[model samples]
Target: MPLSRTVRCICIEISKKRFNPKSLEKLEIIPASQSCQHIEIIATMKKTGEKRCLNPESKAVENLLKAVSKERSKRSP
Candidate 1:
């Protein structure tokens, strides 16, 4: 299934980060609440202890920042 506009936007924002752009393809946006519009964006690094939680709002940007920081840490030996 094709991704929603909101998901696409979030993916685009995530792709802008320094981490592997292909990782965005693995991103999953799941609805957190059936009643409300709250959603969760999840991204997991392969074989690495990296996971991120983000909302579609401003928190998404913050989460992406954290993801980048984590990516940097993983890259650093």
Candidate 2:
């Protein structure tokens, strides 16, 4: 028998409704692919170093992403 090899989505269950942008240490955006059919947003908490999965379709998530992008652009030369 051959062993089937396949990548899997890291997040099992998405986190609660909202997150504090200031508390987010990092945000990782995973595009839809074979393993995961939908966009996945993962956030790392600054203090606890905990990871949380967020809903990509939420308005709050959109705003948080925009803010992070803007901040990064400002830092770039």
Best by lDDT: 2
The sequence of per-residue lDDT tens digits that candidate 1 reaches over residues 1-71 is 88564553323333323455345434566654543345556666565646655344434445666787999
Q: Each candidate: what lDDT? A: 0.54, 0.79
Q: Backbone clashes in each candidate structure, one number apiece?
A: 0, 0
Candidate closest to the true structure, highest TM-score: 2
TM agreement with the true structure for every prediction: 0.34, 0.69
Write down the RMSD of all candidates, one decimal each: 12.6, 4.2
Q: Give the residue spans of candidate 2 off by over 4 A.
A: 1-7, 68-77
